[model samples]
Target: MDEKRLCLAHDDSLRMLRLARRCDDLVLAPAPARVLRDADGSIDPAALVAALPNELFAPTAQNPVDLRFDDDASRSGCSLVRSCPGLLRLPDDAYLEVLTAEGDPLCVCGSTVAHVLVEAGPLAMTSAAVTLGRAVGAGRLSRDAALVRLTGFAMELCGRYARDPLAPLVGDVVHDIEPVSSVRELRAFLDEPTGLHGVELARMAASYANDGSGSTMETCWYGVFCLPPRLGGAHLTRPLQNVALDWPAEAAGLVSHERMRPDFHWPRYETACEHQGGDHTSEQALEEDSRRARDYELCHIHYLPLTKKDARDVNAVTALLAQLLSIIAPYETDAFARRARRMLNDEGVCAARRVLLAQLLPPRLRWCDGDA
Candidate 1:
């Protein structure tokens, strides 16, 4: 953020520009001379490489760095390097499209890399999510994995002031947007015809994805409730995620906190659900959860809190599904409950969630044994 330092958009910045190439060329580092250009405002590979730190160019194949144009007209190619690390790549056509937006996407400062705030965060996330869908279509990544990331990224974006370190780098990249509204934005991006792969799968996930998950665990639980039976989910009505719960006169004096937000809220059914991870099991935490549940009850809302143990058990999840279905739709309760309960242990579901947690969960909370 310091304006004086040469700051290039680090890894995965949507604003970062690259010499476009085929899929094969994407992983291989570009020969310095080939990518660095003497053309107006562009880079010169050799000199820039010498001046830049090795960290700038060492990003993993998953998330590559972007090269930018030179700041000075006189020395068009020796731009200094300011880089960080993250992962995303814009397809050739999509990369060029954003530059034409109203304001200048890139703002260079100093003799080296300049700090940049690209509005293209949403664009990059959308592309990254859908582009991964391409792997799903090709049998590379499971639908569960792709869906978890897409939905997880969406939730992080929707958390307003809260940023999860485990979430994609986009949490800080974009400004004001909610979960469902962001979904609309994603669809809008997809609406424009482009060569992005996995369009169909991307569309489906966007429809099911919502905002406002408080943690990775909540996201896992939310994913369980919303995805269809065929896709290893309970197929329940998608709940409003981490929405506000207003205190009624009867519920007053129940809790000292001025604001209350549940992990999942369903207005029509008057129901709410919370995922209690290990962090919530302390005596103080349990007592607070008890008080909050009482407050929710006082407010005439059904509060359902599930811990990590319940998530690992199929029977427990099935019963929970039955309860959820009964509240949301009595007619479909038993059959849907039975069918979807098996998803808790399904390989695809477990694998998907496992990878998601590994990538996004903070080191202290990560686990690979199963979904939690």
Candidate 2:
């Protein structure tokens, strides 16, 4: 719509708000605001005057504030202001009294005054109503359009989250596991050890040399499928388990899994001591175990350290925060935002991050063993 038209509608809305506010305050005053009833026993002034302060009254009064009720146009059962011009100019209290009396005013002067007030009431609040009304009206945009834009925004945010400094580094890489599930799958993968010819051969490569002999099938799977869609659109379920862990979990080390076992399964050939039983499993063993193989759900899509530029920077952190903010913002809705504002300037961001981490944590991590 053109600016002029939009402004007009907004103005109408503002007026409505002001009228509502006035009606509400006037009704609750110590003295009860009463209205007159016509001969047919209808409340001539309508119940709107009482309903106003309670906020129970509709935004659109029974009759247009600018125009009095029309018999055919309104349910309020009154004639339009043009037809009752004498009643429009009455002072607020005097007109309300005549309305309560439900009869023609005893004097012509009273009628003229009542007519004027009715017109003035609506006009007084028109501008403010328009601005607020326009905002409420504009917010009803198509949800489908919103979803599409949000989805794109989500993807951009995920990239930032993937690059956060708090994320794990490569050399600290202590764990690695195969993508296979059952023994049958393990045997199949081991048997078909593609091109390389050693015990610890590379199953995937990220870059190819001048000869172009090497391929990045593994890296491709890791990047495209391993990372979760923090936004929307992509639909790869259980992406974490699908991740193919390289010898060292680097940025491209992990691939997305359709589903993963709760525990990172170790091969039977790997020594039992190495599997779960080790001499180091002594004092504070439980704490070590808790951190060893995180429950699958606790895993987040992250780049492993490999490049020399794997250092922290402010801009990078800010970008990551932006993306994390988007993902968690929906949950930190109006109610949550209110509480957060009282707590910190970045309350929404902090709340979102906390909520996201809580969601990522496995059920086991929610509590620690203690005396009950």
Predicted candidate 1 versus true structure: per-residue lDDT over 14-84, tens digit per residue:
32322111111222121222111222334434333432335324433344344433234423323333232
Q: What value of lDDT does candidate 2 attain over all alpha carbons?
A: 0.24
Cα error of candidate 2 at position 217, Å: 40
Off by over 4 Å in 1: 1-11, 14-41, 44-64, 67-121, 130-134, 143-145, 160-181, 195-198, 253-257, 313-316, 326-372
lDDT of 2 by residue, 61-101 (tens): 44432323223332233331122111222223211111122
Q: Against the unseen true structure, what C-alpha lDDT does each candidate score?
A: 0.50, 0.24
Q: How does each model score on TM-score?
A: 0.61, 0.16
How close to the true structure is residue 328 of candidate 1, measured as C-alpha lDDT? 60
Best by TM-score: 1
